[model samples]
Target: MDTGKKVGDLFGRLGKVPGRGVGIGLQLLVGAGGLAYGVSQSMYTVEGGHRAIIFSRLGGVQNEVYAEGLHFRIPWFHYPIIYDIRSRPRSISSPTGSKDLQMVNISLRVLARPDAVALPRIYRQLGTDYDERVLPSICNEVLKSVVAKFNASQLITQRSQVSLLVRKELTERARDFNIILDDVAITELSFGKEYTAAVESKQVAQQEAQRAQFLVEKAKQERQQKIVQAEGEAQAALLLGDAVTKNPGYLKLRKIRAAQSIARTIAQSNNRAYLDANTLMLNLTDLGYDQGATRAGTSKK
Candidate 1:
């Protein structure tokens, strides 16, 4: 009787619980939730300026790449590796030896991007660490090669040319690894302290030499000017001596002109003096008047 009472009590408690349909509904809800979560996990998104490659556990790397949009893959089996395909700027400081055996320190800026079409190949070859793994070695090698061709002074003078050579060589080398080199710049070039001091000394010496050359040229010009002035004076003296020797009446005529000028000045002054023609004629004999008369007589004969 107790066992029948206990079984009846168990049946009564079970009837008070929820029905089987409710249990089935709850299990369905749980399964649907799990499916939705799995679907969400299977869906992946690639943002703008980014690219993705798929790695499958069973089939290796998928050749097709996903661009910036929604993508789907098998859950727990396939993975998406994303890469930033923007132009990346990287700086490198390298110590190299110049052709003249001088130590040179070079700072460079490199603009690089991966070739989108060959991204899969890039990942396979260099993985995602392309900047760290590939760029440094290539840049260093090319820089060293280019630097080796130039002396330390040439490095400063032909900085642009050196940069161009490096960019050209690096572009070709990086293409082999599926990278595109956009541009390169040499930001800084430095040498040893002894080299810098020597350069300064040489510049100072050149400036001093130029100044000395200018002074020498100025002295030569001054000396030439003085010689020209002396020659002019000598020519004038010779012309005067020739005039005196060739014409005896020339000095007498000059004296007469000077006397006339003095008489005009006296006439214009507040205090005036008048000399008669007889007095002027009397003074003419004392002032070499006979020389003029004799020259006139000779011309007439």
Candidate 2:
């Protein structure tokens, strides 16, 4: 009977525990529902290096933009559209040519940053895909406007000027898109194979012309050098002649050498050659005697 009483008490305690379990289950369900409701109604955070544009479900203007930090909004109704505010690169390709109908491919690399303040306005009109809608349009228009002003040769040689024109035009056009153009670089320029060959041939001809000019200048300098050398030798000869005339024995030595050279030549010939200094002096004395007699006779008369 004592054992039966103990079993009956255990059953009573087990029935009380089931009642408590039911109450606890009700509390847990209510807590879970409350948590779910809280999470669904909560505001989410958007962080830095990013910008958000608030779009209205009704469709119209996105008037508010969130930049660079935590932000909150109604979960189901209002949502955030994130856009990167960092530097980005965009390329623009165009089929451009000179006035001569030479088709060349032109491409430019552009550095850009979205204006944080103007994000809402930009998102409303241009949307998140600014590269396709705004960037290419700007590039095409700018390139066409720039290319139209120059010839192929000028555009190739003066690329900086072309880039400047692109930058200025694109920057102005990008104002509505909230894009700030940092730089526009003309990175690639390709010409047709035939045009390239013609350019090479022209360059080769120019190099040859320069080479010929250099050779002509060298030859002219060489000719002038020869003329100057001859003139110098002539002046030296005149000076030497003056020096020889000033010195008495200089002519006598030269005459002796000349006579010896003549004697050597005559030795091989049948012609008789006499070399007598005394005979030479006697002839000079006889010429003086004749001149003196003529002067004395004229005086006497």
Candidate 3:
């Protein structure tokens, strides 16, 4: 019984010591946690649409790029730089001058991606924020240079060509920085107020000029119509004069026909009408062709 109590006391005293089994256990726990942390750091995952590049403390950036999947690296000697290799959208805007010295505001939309194969070079030179570093600079450069080659009117008229030129130049330029442009476009464009007003005024003036030309043509056509009418009236008068001179009885015949038409009109009227020698229409009856006797009134026998 004394031996058992003494052994129990000894164990209790050892447990109360400043550092022994407890210190060793704490040290072992710390070592295990550090080892677990290092292993976790050594293994990384590259998700879909992402790429990775390695930087070695001793050897510098590796020339090879890592693709999506599980990848391994030396925990302390190497660091991984991950990049989004997917096409992403970015825009740039600038106020620039045209070839005609007109102020123009333009915006460009770029669909860009880091060249998958050039990821190593990109990390070596440009680092992770490659798009931020290169896109705006190249967009502005291309926009300004392309805009300067066109007049304000041409810029509006040849907008498609301008966009094409910008895309070509910007693509070539961004390529140098290990950036690939999936697509490029000039999304917005506007001219200065003064230039816009001038364009509108010029269009209005052209319309007015066209209207004036139309009016002049209309007047010419009307004048031609009047000249043709006058010629026809003169020719008809000449024909009548020659007929009267050639046959003296023609005037008498014409007069007789006019009297007949007037008499018929009066006869057909609904109102009662009376006639005397002066008031009655002359030569209305079908009188014979002897002038003296016809002038003498003849009733139908």
- The best candidate by TM-score is 1
How accurate locally is residue 61 in candidate 2, as Cα lDDT from 0 to 100? Answer: 49
- Stretches of candidate 1 above 4 Å error? 1-25, 238-301
lDDT of 1: 0.87
- What are the Cα lDDT values of the candidates? 0.87, 0.77, 0.86
Stretches of candidate 3 off by over 4 Å are 1-38, 232-301
Count of clashes in candidate 2: 0
How would you encode candidate 1's per-residue C-alpha lDDT over 26-141 as one tens digit per residue? Answer: 99999999999999989999999999999999988889988999999998899999999898999998999999998888988998888888888888888998888988988899
Q: What overall lDDT, based on C-alpha atoms, would model 3 receive against the true structure?
A: 0.86
**Residue ranges of candidate 2 with Cα displaced over 4 Å:** 1-23, 29-37, 56-62, 234-248, 251-301
Clash statistics: count for each candidate? 0, 0, 0
Candidate 3 vs. true structure, TM-score: 0.70
lDDT of 3 by residue, 1-301 (tens): 9999999999999878867778999999999999999999999999999988888999998888888899989998998888999999998999999998999999999999999998888887888888888888878888999999999889988999999999999999988997888999888999889988998999999999999999999999999999999999999999977766565466668767777786798899998777763354364343454453334323211
C-alpha lDDT (0 to 100) for residue 170 of candidate 3: 92
Clashing pairs in 2: none
Residue 198, candidate 1: Cα error in Å is 1.4
